[model samples]
Target: MDLDTGVALSRHDDHVDPFPVRRAEPAHAVPAGRMGYDLGAERLLLHTVQSAEAFESLLTTGTLRPDPELAEEAFTDAYEWIHRMMAARLPTRGEGALWFWARTRRKHLVDTCRRSRGRVLLTCRVPRERVLLSHFDEWHLVLNKGLGMPRLPGESEDDAFARWEEEHDDFDARLRAAGMRDAPVRDWPADLRTEIEKSWESIFDRGNYGPFECWQGTTHALNNDEVLEAVRII
Candidate 1:
């Protein structure tokens, strides 16, 4: 299968239209690439979503939140609920399927973790070494999907790199269409870091958020400065 087909299917349109744009269907409901280890014919199936209202509701106003210590537990509860919801319609028995949600600059990411009950695998912007690896049972892996390039199965490493380079411009254009006007850090002045810190602090003060700590991925590594540059240009 063409990699672009899969890549296109994986990503959501980031562009913001002035008109009231009706939200598209959830990504998890659609067919996606299979993940996890396969045992003979017994392959582990998976799905991913940028957002899940069902999962979000369980954590936000549910009985799952009893105290600040149960923050991770709440996240785990949401994760499990999402898994079961997806697994019921999927072929796999939910033994080992993967699901992920990302938060680009949302400050509440950490508070979300603090109020959760179970473990949450947060992908944040900080370095991996700074994080407590023991909190998560499995160490997170970095998935490098360049620009608009879709992820394909069985593609050669060389081909994937070539595709990333060729499609980067398209990806950049797509980002521009989104409300993101400038690159992440370049757009920020010396005084703006204070605002970023305050945003994080506000979320920490409130116990109604989730964890989304930034760290280094094994496959692709980008420093904070580099990441900011890329986002700004987009």
Candidate 2:
């Protein structure tokens, strides 16, 4: 079967040295050229109801909203925990694109939370993108966009990566068969590359497609875990 253009992936060696530590960096910018989707009325209604219920629970219990400081700590810790938890389940269909973005964005979100002294706002995205949760940080939003593909119970990371690579090779074969292999690294068909070069939007429309929705929100409020969750799912 041909691999979906949206699912192109790169491979990494499993035998590489362990404990490859690197300096942490914050997520600097919103991905450019990604398109955003509008939630439908039904989704909006469901989310609205969910939000009301959650808030009601807090009110009924007389639970005071934590100082923005505590809330930030809770959110940041929860988000980081979730990110590692998901990583341990690696190579599961949508891990790369999802996790890569999450790893990058999480640093920024946490730093923003730490520095803001707890003055960030939180919001959630409609579930159409399969995101379990999301929030807007000061400058960007982190979304939990899960993938459409299901992960079978008991699948190991190695097994998952093996399967993904096999599928990738198969897709490449199909592309080659279609005479699209002449320039895998460079521009082959002028018209196609030209379209990609013209604009980021055009690149997404005509270049390689991927499985992710635009999770727009202020960068400050977005927690790293939420963003990572979205990236993995996507």
Best by TM-score: 2
User: Poorest 10 consecutive residues of model 1 by lDDT?
Assistant: 225-234
Q: Per-residue lDDT of 36-89 in model 1, one digit per residue for the tens? A: 211112211211121233323323343111122322442442233333433443
Task: Evaluate all candidate structures by whole-model CA lDDT and list the values in order.
Answer: 0.27, 0.28
Q: Estimate each model's TM-score.
A: 0.21, 0.23
The positional error of residue 118 in candidate 2, measured at the CA in angstroms, is 18
Stretches of model 1 off by over 4 angstroms after superposition: 1-38, 42-156, 181-234
For residue 189, model 2's alpha carbon misses the true position, in angstroms, by 14
Error of 1 at 205 (Å): 42
How high is the lDDT of residue 141 in model 1?
Answer: 9
